[model samples]
Target: MSVKPQSASAPFAGPFALGTLAAADGPAFPALVDSEEQVLDLRTALDDPALTMRDLLERWPAVLPRLRALVADPGAVRRPLADFRVLAPVEPRQVFQSGANYRQHVIDLHVAHRAPDDERPEEERRAEAAEIMDRRAAEDLPYVFIGLPSAITGPYDDVTLPAWAKKPDWELELAVVIGRPAYQVSAEEALEYVAGYTIANDLTDRATVFRRDMPQIGTDWLRSKNAPGFTPLGPWIVPTESVTDTGDLRLTLKLNGEVMQDESTKDMIFDVARMVSYASQSTQLLPGDLVLTGSPAGNGMHWGRLLRDGDVMDASITGLGAQRTRCLAEES
Candidate 1:
């Protein structure tokens, strides 16, 4: 099947991004999205109507050059992005999330959740937290936890705020998409396994984060972070080559048009390479898996303003696209 050439200009000049989009009359399919909000149906472009994002990643070495060629010289019919509903870029079989990996975010959490009976000055507490962070950076490994892929949602999807969640919050993160299989890989070689980068808003219910009922059991990530639609995954995935500097990318999240979290990836205690390498030590990383780098400082808890019904979150990572998610009250 040959793709018909188009007279309209190409959507982008260089490296392209990938996404999942569905027209009103069809099922969701993998697509190539351009910077100008245009889309080329990947299934149609590649002449394989059954192609998925996972299929491309699994065979990335061969597919990469073809994708680059397709981007440069169009052979497919292009359509306006508004003609379809965007979905989560990829449906990973396993999702690994790094927690407390941002130095300042950890300190912010410490300050925000100070012991009620403690009488220390705020500045003194902050200093202590900072010192602890420094020590942890030098001595600790990345704190990784498993996240259910069932929680994944589209970039523009409306997330239902669970009735029982009193302190729902946003955590915008830079998500690394794995292309090559990796097992116990070194940090230096970890990036070679990366397929691309995308955005994820790791919504959490602060009230459920710590199991107060059983303090000894500690944090309950499954209950606090894995609600359906809690993770707004992507607008698109920008290939690794497109991102020049992963270490310095800026992450910005705006709540109701006001900037809530704005920080750089440089603040991460464990960078992307380290996070991916650490996770690979325990389990083999496969194509289409996601490695979520921890969120930076400035969550709702720190601002004393948790999520409520009708709140809109606009999250973006440098080089990767942005995602706008709205919050709705769960129906009784």
Candidate 2:
């Protein structure tokens, strides 16, 4: 799909910085920028703004650095984005996620797959995720999974489950938006290339994620995430430049204001810098490709839980906006 353009004439009403944008005036993505928030819509903001994504890095070198400063200052973009209706910050060319980058998550997932009839030592269970851990010793390789580009949705959007879904669980994760084309990049140079960060809930249905019955079709991980409104995101992408410490950001998941998951990204064993450099070896990341850094330890499946109709879930990251959604039953 072709990327859209931003209207030159006040795309939004309130204070806004250079990169921030409002929705396309109607039933577009909701307004992320209001009198009280700092937001940007990479899709809308990049729209023919006299500069392209590639242009910002070279021809208009000052612009990229300005964006970094604005996001960090929060208050800097106020005048340009005060009234803009916020939209998803980026229009990714590809979307991916790490499988066991965080130690706690590795532990939780192994526990979930435990056999009811047989017993294995916890060390044995962790070995599965461990065998490949060393691959990341040099970079983000060895522990990631490809997510369907179509599976991703804008932040603040609703998540719809398949009618046959018996389990809908949330995996709280932090996602990174790539800023440019990259291949064989070094970890030392990774952070400089990231556009920003956002909160993501990798919704899944384990019963269908890896089913053998679907031989006529294919592995069902896509089906698990491809349900309409499945991936809830938004608030907005906090430009990576603004975040000096991606390692320590706090993440939380709540249902009706009650905390369900609370942890810090600092626990990530692989971290963002390595993931980007490693992913670049094979996939060329273009502007807007999202890399969902793995989730932390707390998830519903750990407790035999799942989302039911009318359940409102909200996920928040330290600097990113909170995403809210209500799970609804699939249509009969």
Say which candidate scores most in TM-score.
1
Residues 1-332 of candidate 2: C-alpha lDDT, one tens digit per residue: 11111221222222322232443463333123433444444334444434333334232334565444444564433334434444455555677777677776776665666789748777777776565454444454446667776666655555667787788888888888776678889989988778667777888887787766756765567667667666665546555545668889888888766788898988787889888887888878777688888888777776666888777787778766566767777778
Over the stretch 242-302, how does candidate 1's per-residue lDDT look in tens digits? Answer: 9888899999999988999999999999989999999999999999999999999889988
TM-score of each: 0.93, 0.75
lDDT of 1 at 21: 84
User: Which numbered prediction scores highest in lDDT against the true structure?
Assistant: 1
Off by over 4 Å in 2: 1-62, 66-85, 112-140, 214-219
Cα lDDT, all candidates: 0.87, 0.64
List where candidate 1 sits over 4 angstroms from the true fold: 1-14, 115-118
Q: State residue 289's C-alpha deviation in candidate 2, in Å.
A: 1.0
Which 10 successive residues of model 1 have the least lDDT summed?
1-10
